[model samples]
Target: SRGRGFGRGRDRFFSSDYYPYPHRPGYPWAPTLSREDEVRMLKSEADALKRSQKEIERRLGELEKEE
Candidate 1:
């Protein structure tokens, strides 16, 4: 049937748009760690990055002032 074919084609197109990673053995679909661990790790990394960025900006300002 023409209508059935079009419906299948539309479903296929929409399904293709939502591409998911291929499932593999021993792979988790989501984070396995507790929320606290995740938040702590993220915050630690973010704070370190922020400190590094501030240091870079301070050095740049010093260079500009010297020029």
Candidate 2:
């Protein structure tokens, strides 16, 4: 019967063509970077954040003055 076929498929767990790869037991791959590169990226991000904060504060001050 069709019900028997469906039950067998469910038991085997092999119905679809899509299958996932088995995970390897180990630490994930992470890239290593030099200290100079890390510091440059951090400083650039800090400068951008500082600029955005200053702009936000200026807008808030303008809104306060208008109130």
Candidate 3:
């Protein structure tokens, strides 16, 4: 029981060379966020979706005109 201890083992497990898969989560630990940050993030995503939707509609209309 007197080896280098748990932290050393855990560190070796997470070291860069040990990554075996492409889909590893970007962060090593769970993130922390408050209600305000969560709301802001959701609003931004909604705005992006709406803008992309309108752009897609415009592109579809243009394609229809070409035919």
Candidate 4:
């Protein structure tokens, strides 16, 4: 243990997820999620999906070039 954080015992982060519900166990259907939170979450998910799709497309293109 020394300088700043991330010393000896601070080797890893918590196993528990900060984003609750759907992503984590026992969260269940949260009908109380605010409209703003829902919108933000949806936007983030969409962005993630778009990125994944792009990555898949790029890999497919590379594979096609190989063949």
Best by TM-score: 3
Model 2 vs truth, CA RMSD: 10.1
Model 2 lDDT per residue over 1-67, tens place: 3433365553244443334456435688989879999999999999999999999999999999999
| Worst ten in a row by lDDT for model 1 | 10-19
Query: Candidate 1 residues 1-67, lDDT tens each?
Result: 3332355554433452434557424645885879999999999999999999999999999999999
Best by lDDT: 3
Query: Given candidate 1, what's the lDDT at residue 28?
Result: 58
Writing each residue's lDDT as its tens digit, candidate 3 over 1-67 gives: 4433356654434463456678656857868889999999999999999999999999999999999
Full ranking by TM-score: 3, 4, 2, 1
- Compared with the true structure, what per-residue lDDT tens digits does model 4 show for residues 13-59? 53323544465556467577799999999999999999999999999
**Which scores better on lDDT, 3 or 4?**
3
Ranking by lDDT: 3, 2, 1, 4
- Residue 41, model 2: lDDT of 93
Give stretches of model 1 more than 4 Å off: 1-31
Clashes of 1: 0
Residue 31 local lDDT, model 2 = 94
TM-score of 2: 0.55
